[model samples]
Target: MKAKKTTPQGNKEITDLILDSIADGVFTIDQGMRITTFNKAAEQITGYARREVVGQFCHDIFKADICFKMCPLKHTARTFESIVNMEVNILNRQNQEVPISISTSILKNRKGEVVGAVETFRDLSLIHELRKEISRQYTFQDIVSKSKAVAKLLNILPDVAQSDATVLIRGESGTGKELFATAIHNTSLRKKGPFVAVNCGALPETLLESELFGYKKGAFTDAKRDKPGRFKMAAGGTLFLDEIGDLSKGTQVKLLRVLEQREYEPLGSTSTEKADVRIVAASHQDLSSLVKKGEFREDLFYRLNVMKLEIPPLRDRKEDLPLLVDHFVRKFTEKTGKRIRAVSKRAMKRLLDYDYPGNVRELENVLEHAFVLCKGPEIKTSHLPENLTPSNHRTAPQATGKTSRLPELEKQVIVEALERYGWDRSQAARELGMHRSTLWRKMQRHGIEVP
Candidate 1:
């Protein structure tokens, strides 16, 4: 049987039906820049009816950010080229700024004469919201982690911020102590004020005191002018003193004075200036141990330890490894404009097996090195740093016979106990005759996540 040829009217109806069925907004403009056709999706996205938009000026209806400057449709029409997935913001009838990605193509007649242009645009608001939601899951105030240890600190951070007491943050190097300090400043009542940070360990003994308390003109050979110190610069906000344990004994006396009396004087200056900044200190060394050894001043330690926070090292919080890896992948993707999907399973296992001596900072560097070498969507084990090889993995002492299966048996028992108690870690810990922290640590070691 021969099929009858469809008429022009039937073809026009079919095209209109297809346009209405599309998920993206579709519209066409004439040579005069007037809307010639508007589909159902266009009306839905712009909050305007087809009848109201047809024959109207495209710019007047669309109101896109680039309508007058570098319009995609105009560019396509003039260059005889197509623009695909160019992101732009547009104002809807409700006057809301809606993010959308638009593609444009030149519309031509049968004789190859350019008569108009067609554009297809998709709403990106939902995608942006989803990205924000995903970011919030493993991130708190820009500090990324899913470990219970970090979560516990985050829970009390608001109260700590409100207290305005001197804070001493203890953590290994590269554990993101400054991030916590910044979080405290950002959440405090003085959020609108400035935040100044100085590394006590990074400066020399002579420069450290002058840096913290500034120096008057002609105070020393290098004294140029009267300069404001970190305390002055951070007057209404926070002054983060990093590696406070490195401060010399004499410098510690000055710092203790400032903390106790809230006053200090610049070198070669007679009068004292009132200090108004909140102090947040960090130290990688154990201050208590240093105090016992007479290396760190006991008076200064007592003053700085008012509201203490201890950040756990990356090795102890291995459960956050996957979340941190995914975060770095997303971060580097944006920074390098590469569309990396994920770290491969084998590569992730290699990452999980390693004990990071340098903590989160080392993990970030490892991922960044992988990003530089990776050309594909997934980062493979081969792309990791040479030092991350399987040979460098931490191994337990050699055990023979029944002892070899102890870890496997222990993991199985823990899993069974947690399952039997409805995944209530406390209940399971009690049932297993272990402390909650011990059970939690075991769970992380076994790679168990809450279901």
Candidate 2:
């Protein structure tokens, strides 16, 4: 058999075939930034055909956010450098934003003369969707956590949401009780209806009644017109009463009446309006304890307590710190347009050492503070709040009454995981994203009884 000689045409055809076979979209642009060659993947990703995009301006076809401002091809051309895996957004033919990771390199002639630039981009839409799905597994609406206690609550949320029973949420201040309330409303049949929230503690007794039940025209000195209250606004929807424990006895009686009769009269008005709203009440104070002390109405407490949700404080679910930290970092990075990526080991250690008495809200504030102070890509020890620093606040004491060690924290988390999984190390290891053998070794090291 005679070996056939490869021709220039054959070589060009092979190159085109190879480019078209790749999963990533590939295109080349001339010095003037006009599209020269477009591959099959490029056509599919951008919703533009090869012939249609050929000879057109690259920016017009891509419509990337950085095309006009920070064009990657332009940067490569000027610096004689290459860009690898730069994440960016592009508008397709339908004007929908598509996330893509692009790599750019200079297209040079056989003589090494710069002729054009070539870009390869991979559609990140699927990746983004998968990320969202993974995030959803650990999240409920805006509430994010991976703790067993939270998971147990989340598992029961669907049933709770289906029921129209008044929901009572209990937690410490800044523990995101309102988030849980909102979650209930969002997941409930009243999702499409309005959600009105009122802080009972924020208003005085006189104003509280009018705020909850509204006031008629000329009801009082400030009653210029008939103003609808939170209940009226939340009609056919859900009403979130925050800090309900602070409601005065009089207001409590009125609220209890509405709960029982599903009706209330506006101040200075004889007509009663039907209370059609589903009530979701939240309080940092323990309503049971309040009732025991006669500070809260027992009947009203029982009414609101028909369905209850207890939010664990940050200190109790330290296992969720990493997820929460990442969530906030992304949140603030997008909000502040900072490039901060992650928390430093030292800073994370500092965070892990402290007992967050203020709970999740305080953690968010701490990160926000770090974001403001951090000029670099990562947050450092110096960027943390004063209280989180060693000099300002004493280290959190462990059961031994000394500074808590990372091992102690690890052991606690491991034990919790074991107990959560009914002492099934295999299942607990899977939930912890660790290997079973590794979990067993850790258990042995920590003296955790293996079952």
> Candidate 1 on 113-190: residue-level lDDT in tens?
889999999999999899878655556688888788898899889899988999999997678888899999999988
Clashing residue pairs in all predictions, respectively, total: 0, 0
- TM-score list, all predictions: 0.59, 0.60
lDDT of 1: 0.86
lDDT of 2 at 264: 94
- On TM-score, the leading prediction is 2
Residues 396-445 of candidate 2 have per-residue lDDT tens digits of 44357556576766677678768887998777665444445446656777
Lowest summed lDDT across 10 adjacent residues in model 2 is found at 389-398
Residue pairs in clash, model 1? none
Pairs that collide, model 2 = none
Predictions in order: lDDT: 0.86, 0.86
